[model samples]
Target: MKNRTKIALLLLSSFGLMACDVATNTSPKTDPNTTAQTAVVSEASSSDNVTKEKVETTKAEVVMKAKTTSDGKLILGEQEWVYIPGLKESFKARVDTGATTSSVSAVDIQPFERDGEDWVKFKIEHDGINSDEIELPVERWVKIRQSSAEGTQRRAVVVAWLQMGDYKAQTEFTLADRTHLTFPILLGRSFVNGVAVVDVSQKYIQDKHKE
Candidate 1:
């Protein structure tokens, strides 16, 4: 009777241990499931933060792109004479908003080097016997599309100063053969845009010889 009582107590203790082991295994599974849910919430939060940052960056760029002048600009005529004091030469220019770049008549373009810099020599038409020639260091080169031709032409550009009446500007000019055109100089939008407003009905509104 004593041996049987001892065996019965041992069996009851083993059953209790088995129940504890089962509970421990089930508790570990629940912890991993909770961790997975937390990781998913964290990943979702990070994605939302990235989207908000992009929205703020785009808004800043939009604000930067929207720019305007505070003061008004000069109103100019369609036709004006631009005088260059350095050359003592004046050119009749057609203020054209259609063209993006300004053009000047130049013939016999010869590339030369001066002071280890690239220079260009071109002749300008005048009422004088000798072909009046000008030489300057090449500022840059531009590829332009011509209305009279099919393909584009690469022309040499230079920076020069010009006077119209009260307005004076240092602008870029591209050299080209403009003998076939009525005006020797075509003052494009690059020279007049934002600074002057052109009236097509007006002519010589500003004088170069007005001193």
Candidate 2:
């Protein structure tokens, strides 16, 4: 009877140890909820990249036309009529983007003093040999270095009203000996860059004022 009781106690202890092993045998399982959250975060990151690209494209399109028209239409032909309100005169002007500063034909330049400032008198002779003496305060002087000239020619600079069609601007101009040149006035990039677009094939496209 003693041996039988000892055997029965051993069997009870073995059963309890088996039960504990079975409870601790379960390994960690990957959570389905966590995998779903990771996928959603990945999708959101892709969406953000697409939205950023769209914004950049829109910004570029909007800024592309900044240097375009301002107050009025800025279009010009190869040659057009230019009116100087200060001089009450209008003349044909050649649109030249190649040149840097606009020029007006002048001859017999005589320097003098006015209001304690440097002034100059120049004559403009056009059709039928008609000449008009223009006198104005010399704002500044520009040095002209060209391939055709023997030396640097210093010319007088002045601001004058230049009108074409409906566009009018008080733009800077330099007095030059343009008698040898074809056109009396040459409109340069200073007036063309931000003010006008030159169409090389067109000429005299703007309306001319009548007397």
Candidate 3:
């Protein structure tokens, strides 16, 4: 009887060891529904990021389309009519973005003194026609390098009031001989920096200014 009891206890211990080993080796089952939900959430987050990028790109495009600023400025073309209040005349102007300062056609440019201040006398000459003699105090002088001529030429700069369409402002112009050029007035970046915008494809976008 003692031997039979000992054998039964050994069998019971073996059965418990086998059950514990099976539990340790088995892996927990994953729920298919929960996995599907997680994938959907990740996809949605990626889509939202893409949408935000598109919104930022659209705002930049809008600013580019609205070329004009809040102040009274104009969208100028490759060529426009510019009126000079000092000369009381208007001339065809070429809008050149490459030039740093504006220039006007002048001839017989001579520097003099008035009231102990430096002054200059010159006449606008273009297409072989000479204008009336005009005198003004020289604001400054600038040296320009000519592509066709040797060395740099010294030009006299003067302040002048300009009118184009509805926009009007006082800007500096370097007096030079532009008789050989097609346009007498060459509008440069200084004049159009804050006053106008240039569109190279179009020409004569603004109407001729009237008195």
**Candidate 3 segments whose C-alpha is farther than 4 A from its true place:** 1-71
Residue ranges of candidate 2 with Cα displaced over 4 Å = 1-71
The TM-scores, one per candidate, come to 0.59, 0.62, 0.64
Give the alpha-carbon lDDT of every model: 0.79, 0.81, 0.87
Q: Among these predicted structures, which one has the highest TM-score?
A: 3
**Deviation from native of the Cα of residue 74 in model 1, angstroms:** 2.6
The regions of model 1 sitting more than 4 angstroms off are 1-72, 126-131, 147-150
List all candidate RMSDs to the true structure: 18.0, 13.7, 11.7
Q: Order of all candidates by lDDT, from best down to worst? A: 3, 2, 1
**Model 2 local distance difference test score:** 0.81
Task: Tell me which of candidates 1 and 2 scores higher on lDDT.
Answer: 2
Error of 2 at 148 (Å): 3.3
| Minimal lDDT window, size 10, model 2 | 64-73
Ranking by TM-score: 3, 2, 1
Deviation of model 1 at 123, angstroms: 1.8
Cα error, residue 38 of model 2, in Å, equals 72
lDDT of 2 by residue, 1-211 (tens): 9999999999999999999998899778899999999999999999999999999999987654332356655667899888777566778899989988898888898889988998899887565344677788888988888897688978888877777776778777888877777788899988988777777876876767554
